[model samples]
Target chain A: MSILIDEKTRLLVQGITGGEGSFHTQRCIEYGTKVVAGMTPGKGGAQVFGVPVFNTVESAVRETGANASIIFVPPSGAADSIMEAADAGIPLVVCITEGIPVMDMISVHSFLKGKPVRLIGPNCPGLISPGKCKVGIMAGEIHKQGNVGVVSRSGTLTYETVAQLTGLGIGQSTCVGIGGDPLLGTNFVDVLKLFQEDEETKAIVLIGEIGGTMEQDAAQFIKDKVNKLVISFIAGASAPPGRRMGHAGAIISGNTGKAQDKIEALSAAGAIIAPNPAEIGKTVKKSLKY
Target chain B: MKIHEYQAKALLSQYGIPVPSGDVAGTPAEAKKIAAGLQGKVAVKAQVYAGGRGKAGGIKLAANADEAEKSASGIIGARLVTHQTSARGAPVSHVLVEKVVEVRRELYLSIVIDNARKMPVMIASEAGGMDIEEVTLTSPEKILKAYIDPSAGWQDFEGRKLAYGMNLSAQQVKPAVKLMANLYKLFHEKDCSLAEINPLVITGDDSIMALDAKLNFDDSALFRHEDIRRLHDPAQDDPFEARANEMGIKNYIKLSGNIGCMVNGAGLAMAVLDLINYCGGNAANFLDIGTVNNTSAVISAFKVFTADPDVKAILVNIFGGMARADTIARGIIEAYQQIDIKVPVVVRLAGTNVAEGKRLLAESGINYIEAADFLDAARKAVDASKGGRN
Candidate 1:
């Protein structure tokens, strides 16, 4: 009933032998996610947290029938790991590894065309389907199973919002951290489409940040398509206008990708804007007449 | 990741793409010497990371070696403040001294990764040297675009299309197309976020030359290109930021407010800034200690923040979402022992071992105030920023 993942999802952890990989793999397993297999090229035939390890994603998918993947590979190999997962027919791929090169992502995007895979992040915190499954680095205790779908570009901000929402007795169907890189696999519009279709997601909360056209494009998409109540929050309102914050974006995109501009866009699109990060859950509460 | 105009020109020339005959000069004498080699009139342009140099008086034309010396001498030590820079402007340690080309026509050519398209795109406009954004508004037809498919790569036809779209003649079309292809090659090979020729001029003799160049590399991809990394000018960054960069501390950006911030993760650091602003105060800087929470990094970050004269108070917020609060407390304690912090520090801890973290901080006798939660901490930070009692 939830979007992207559920209780039936079988997850594979890439780079399962590494420090972050082993640590978060245990965390994901502890969160009740079915961590069926792990992939670490040469370190196959091993088990971590009682999950079977495979040498390659293809074998991992073939043997364990792992349908979803969460990559913890370093920046250099993260892109190839994504392609390997996609090539192996893993329908859902979440890349938790941050700092992947933009060109590598562009190449991955091109390679992913006509493929069945939907990639979530290369520099993101990944996503979670509360109560049922978790496939990211988010603090598991903060999320509660409910109806509102949450998606954001920042990890800690997503946790902050989710913790706030959970405290307000507002649960989420699924929460996604889409990551904060220039070129990502799945953008706001792509995730928004999934949230809009999920029947469990009665309302939605979108958290965005400054610097990128994704929020603006998401606002336009929300204006044209979304039917449910949506509360939007954009962080970095107080961010100093450092170079490349938008100056180059100004020359090319005309839009500076500023907080005020994004806020106005969201508001004009009929999405109730949370004035600040601290007010996000309250704004959603007031907007939905809860 | 942003390289100076001279550096960008060097990369362009390396790829067989034509640029003005220029060499960067650290002194007026060097500039005069470079200009003397070019013989005729030369242009002395301030080598800075910002744009709008032409309009900002960062660029000057010198008819003789003496004039080039005067121009370089004027810009070398002075900060050239453009609309792109803060009011104080970027300091110019070097000037690009180059031969001036007679332009038969000016056109725009650039290759940037288009976020919306999720692919690399080539944008060209016949109406160059002017704002392409304005040109896109006034005459949308003037701005030509060729979206590159990463797998297939940039084709000769796409370059030809751009060259012809700029209304180049039959002979000029080939070289222009070649230049476009070379520029694309440079962009892809160098891992550049942006490779642009503001005025890709058709000279009086019908030769194509990049009169001005700007290249911005992907900061994340800098590891792959050591050659491009060598071009980085540390003098370009703020003193504190440069220090943080040297220490390998990621995402330590200086802001304009009085409250210095130290937080975990970029998202939370930004949220801290928002919470500060939302609480009726502003933050002085954005320092994300990252997920690792290395004690030395915290110490270095604290050192950087405390050194800023603009910072009146410090706020350290750690969500501890798989991170331990006691680790942060130890980091803070370690930082306090290593450095003499003159400002009030408000620490907010969440997640496991909060009591232990609190006890450790309280017993450490560092005088850091503790708040209950994010809001409480933000309020306390705002209050302390106003010189209020703990």
Candidate 2:
């Protein structure tokens, strides 16, 4: 079950004693990632590594039930700690804090309307499912469980496309960065409709870059609902066109945010097109010919 | 971030909108003493930061004050080319002399922030003084929109429902909904990622005004607008992206290509400018240096592409998640022992301390080149920018 999180994802950190939240909450508690609780508004009974902190994400989700939070809260208190983790219900918030302010993400998108919250990234670099779970500042020994889900927008180009799909053995069923901000809280068709309802994701990839239309709306939701093997890649395909550095609604919505207009809209909505950024994991190991 | 249309009509005549009586001038005798105290036809214009600028003559029209001092000496110190600039044009200096208004129609107004409706929209049009992407590609109901709801705010009926969906004139819809609610309070007290006016005319004494203004702001909220960063001009950028954004390396940028790469992560500096232009070379700039473990902002972005003479071949590309790799190999050997570079760099270093950042560049005696990843550092920085030595 590697989608938004895994291994019974408890998490919750929200600026837990600062400095990139106890240094990526001690590498998300050494990558096993249950992390539990931390908050730190007034340094509530502090403790960081052994977890338990709480100054309120409503007292660390009523004493550590936590249900997934993250947020290293800076950039002016990251939209009020993402509406205090969606009014302390935190059904996965994420936000690794990078530079908030797009009018505080349009007031955290009108306070996450119709909120049964999902949020994910104020600036980003936050999810992971490999080896069950991990959150935020990536590089947990370049991830590995297996299934190839990995979405992106670029936190170190999703750790160089998840360390070239865990060095070709191809392992991930969940990576998601969704950050390259121009206002975001999860996109690329909201994590490609959760990697098309992930059945331990058979194959996905997607990396995308250079100003939005979220990869032509994730190539029309992977050609009207993905059936599996995807690939994709874009990453500013040598961004050079009369580079007016972006948007007048891309000259009024013809959206030439280029990269061969998102590689001809994800190869005419069927996907599979890594064509360099060193062939994203050899175009998903030659399209799942694994 | 794109001001000048006389700093967007001096911040839209300080929020009460109605812009027109101008005054920005660097010669042509102060644009003929501001077009000899306005009144009739004037508008000299040309300020830069792209946009058609009256079909690149960078706007003109005068008639008095010695034809606005011969239209500010044919747009002060020439260089405008515009199909939104960069066929190496944009330099002009300053002009803006204003006072033309006599239109009677034109409408368009803007605002921005829609990022797939995360909201702040506005857009509006009446097929305005041409181009709102050709009125949404030929009258898509003459482009009018509204958005705003920042948790129930700015709802003066979303600027009177885009001034009654842009057909105004019920006494111009309450001063065009009080000039779009004081341009949404000067686009929310000047964080302004594009406020624009385009035409927003009406005039010939019917009042509406702002015949073209522009705005933009929000370079990450320009540190709470020091009065919109004193109308920042930095000679309209690209002096190596305003000296790599004055060395804090706000993602450096430049680009004409000679391979400069310098990564740290703006999505791995755009996948090292797309695998160094998909391995044929041509990257010349795009610095990134973020994910701050600062190595002196990577030795001031390696002295900004080793002081760019169209950089010959740099690369560097560090991954180092919390950035270590021997502190970016002692700031690229202290910027190759305090600059005097000549290009050919290449490096590569991966996440965290990659084998003590490749054994401190194989016990330094630096002639760099290392590679082994990112497609062998983009095919050895596109074969060291095609045999460097420039």
Candidate 3:
């Protein structure tokens, strides 16, 4: 069984009337995600991709019993959508919207603290339990139902690693894109905790980037608890200091979040380090002795 | 985006933070006029984004208006290279003329989004006029931090606690507390990624002032703050980057290399950089095409890449998630048709509708080299750059 989602997962699409919202909703439905409802403020009653739409998250949750929410609302409204989903007692909320003001996230993050709901991303690809369900925007064709669990801070990099793994016949129990934003709902440590506890996840692939203390912190967590073989890849090794390489979170500020520092931390923590993106699947395979 | 010191000071002054009266001047004569308006010795500061300007002679204490003019003439049109800047430093075209203050003590004060904490944190140190990171690395105890919970908001008591921790006197506490609170408010209200007062100086008259201001707003959040966005000085940015920014292609940083790499997602873009380097090639720039690919953006991205003379080859790596591979392929083909690109192009497409995207690339008859995977693409791009096929 996967950690966060499976065949039983009933999903809701926030901002379902919007272009990206409607598009991904249909894709997720095609992948058998069971998207039962959609939410748009003004055009609530309008149907999108054959899904029932409601004005408010609470009403949608009440009518359709949608347990999970994937937000495709614009940046300005994405934070409120997350709070609304959480307030409505949706157990999991995955925000696919990018460029939300960090201050908005600061308040939303504080609001989510001690709450029962689990939040995934403000700038992420969301998560998927291969063959069981798909959420957010990751392509379903590249995944296979198996034992390795994958967690990353990026979207396309996750796709790259997953595709390579799938090509090598290494199927995943679950793959979660925690997003590349600085202040995300779920961090590497948070997702790693879930992967460590999952019985089906025999091995784990952690894809991180250069920035923040999340990787180092997750390395500590892995050292302390994770029993499964872990192979990790940290991007931005060729990145210069003090330059943000696309992602709002991916920057080496002073000496804090350098690639070497993260690599040293992870290697010291008994996690096998993939030298490059292409080597990830092979490295994981070698470490798993398969 | 980072604003000039004068602009930051002006914004701070609006928020009730005490800053010395300053005005920016683009010419030496204008600098003299601005300094002539201020009393006592004036500071003629070069208006560039890079730090360590003082050591670079970008900042000078002018005794009179004539000296201010001389300082401005010496600074403006001159590239001031600091330790923080590239060897070929940013050219200074403006100077901020402000009256100097007598400092009894210097303290560091800044409000930054602490990524690890997932909250806005105020970092204050009794040790001032020095790099906070160095201070943090050395005497960590000297760095006092207070995390401001945005939902609960920052309390006056928390500001007062921060003031006390910075060792403010009884008389200095009141203004310091207010200043601290104002800084936090400005940081939150302005959507600032960083609002720093390098030397929050206590004057000899027992009053505190922000001697220096360095405010950086969140580039992504600039859509919300139109006024703050107006403060962005494109002159401080690389010319090509400024053009790219105006074109709404925000994720482009020009580097000094030969291989121009365009890829989807930041993490993967960076991975491509490493892969290029690993394959014995240098990357000319970092460009993330984002999650959505359209023809115009792709055309603009190609225009920017081709504009750089250092670029010898271009690599287009697309592993679509939310992004469609066919769209990326089509954009690349259309961009190639529109632009006169002399550099070799290596295109790798994957994810949604791979077969369709591959077919589109093949049908274009553009002689675009195809890569089997990420590694193949990187290797081909590097090989193509070296004028060889491997």
Candidate 4:
């Protein structure tokens, strides 16, 4: 009943021979993700955690029928890996790599236009279907299968929210990190649309930070189309203007991209503001009760 | 990643863009010589990696070589404070002396990676020499924009169409087309995230020239361009940010606050800062440890925090799902032992081997506050900072 990924979703590991790729792939498999294939040039015929390896994404998809890919390639080659996955016609691509050159994403983003595939992140944590399947580097032990759908821009804060939810016996249906890059594959509005269509997702928890108009756009979409009870938390309340708050996209320029502006917009749009990351689960529960 | 105006103009000129004939000089004598070579009225521009230099007395007009030398003397070795740069001002290491041109009309033109559109976009405005964001917010219709095709490139026809749409003269359109082509080439070749010409001025003879330039390179692509590596202006950047980059820790920018943040990922570190602010606290700086496997990075992070006198408290938030918590815990312990920290530290450790990590922290006998969860940690950090302030 989870959205985007679940028990049936077949995953492919890009850069599977690398230290991060191999380590996370094993963890993902241990958490019950159906990792069917691994892709690393010149390492074709090798097996990582018993997963079949292929030289190219096309060959891997042809042999294993892997419809989704989790890429751990370095920033320099990340855009190429994303384009290759899109070309292979994979329905979903999650790029875990960070610090990708903006110019590289400019080309990759233009190429993905009019394509049916969805790109998740360049500097983001991958998605998880709670206890069913974990396709990212998020702590799987903190997640559980439940009715709440979680979507966020921050990684550790997502884990913190998930841990709090699990502590209160409120599990998530699906959690997606749209990433903190200025030009991300998915946006809050896109993931919200998916969560809105999923029947298992009763209430949603959205974790946002300072910078960009994505939060405002999400609030607008939530007001018009969202039927589920949604509680949100916008971070970087006291962030200084023109300063990038860790993430490339998290910069407060001029009057826009301020946390207060985003909080006000979301609050006016009928979203219960958590005010802090620690209150996300409790805030969602209160919204449900109301 | 932001380069000085002279560097940006040099890059633009290399791509065959029509930039004013100019040369950078490190001293007043060199400035006089460069101005003499131009053989006309010249503009002396102080070289600093920030915008709004024109308003800061950084830009001066010289009627002759002697005047140019005086202007360079006034600017060289002096800090220029612009609206963009802080009150402390940016020290001018060099001056760009260029031949002045007779201006007919000024128009704004730039190509930037539009995140919303997810493509390279061309922004053209009839109103030039002003901030583009203000133009976008006040009179968006005045800004004509077109998304470039990544594979097909920015064709001359597209540039000509934009010129005609913006009501440029027939002669000016030719140079505009050439400028657009060169701009796109420079953008791709230099791996620039942003390349802007604030006042693309049309001369009396109908020739177009870039009067001002600003360029931001992609930090991830620095390994490829050795020329850009040489242009790294550490004077224009925050010392903490530069030091963090050298240590492989993701740290940038410093803020005027009392609480310092140390977290595993960028997004999470931002969230922690936001949470601190939400709880009535201010973050001294934004720091992301970013997948640390070694203790040295942790020590570097500690050194960065301790170096800031305003940092009265520190918050450490890590979700070691990919990295083991015990490893991070050991790193933090090593960092604590290495540095003489005056601020109280609050630790919130989660994920794999978290219990062992917490146990190690407990055994270290360091006077640190431990929180069972993120909320408690934030509350403790904020309260401790407030207490210290009192």
Model 1, runs deviating above 4 Å? A242-254
**Which residue pairs collide, candidate 4?**
A236-B274
Error of 2 at B23 (Å): 18
- Tell the DockQ for candidate 1: 0.57
Q: Count the backbone clashes (under 3 Å) in each candidate.
A: 0, 3, 0, 1
**DockQ-based CAPRI category assigned to the predicted complex of candidate 1:** medium
TM-score of each: 0.96, 0.38, 0.97, 0.96
lDDT of 2 at A203: 82
Question: Which predicted model would earn the best DockQ?
Answer: 3
Could you arrange the candidates by DockQ from highest to lowest? 3, 4, 1, 2
Residue-wise C-alpha lDDT for candidate 1, range A1-290, written one tens digit per residue? 89999999999999999999999999999999999999998889999989999999999999989999999999999999999999999999999887788889888988898898899986788888999999999888888999999988888778888878888999999999887776778888998999999999999999888787778899899999999888998877777664432112211134466788888888899999887777788888888788
- Residue-wise C-alpha lDDT for candidate 4, range A173-256, written one tens digit per residue: 999998988889999999999999999999889888888899999999999999888899887776678877778898887777
Tens digit of per-residue lDDT, candidate 2, span B1-390? 667788778777877887888788988998888788885778788888788888777889988888888878888998888876678887998888888878888988888887887778788887777778767877788787878777665777878888888878788889888888888888887778778788888887788988887888766677777877887889878788888788777756687888877777776776777777777778887677776564687788878887788877888887788777788888888888888787688888887879987897789888888878888888887887888432
- In model 2, residue pairs whose N, Cα or C atoms come closer than 3 Å (at least 3 residues apart or on different chains), thus clashing, are A95-A121, B194-B216, B259-B284
DockQ of predicted model 4:
0.70
Chain A only TM-scores, each candidate in turn:
0.95, 0.38, 0.99, 0.98
**Candidate 2 overall Cα lDDT vs. reference?**
0.79
The DockQ score of candidate 2 comes to: 0.28
Order the numbered candidates by TM-score, best leading. 3, 1, 4, 2
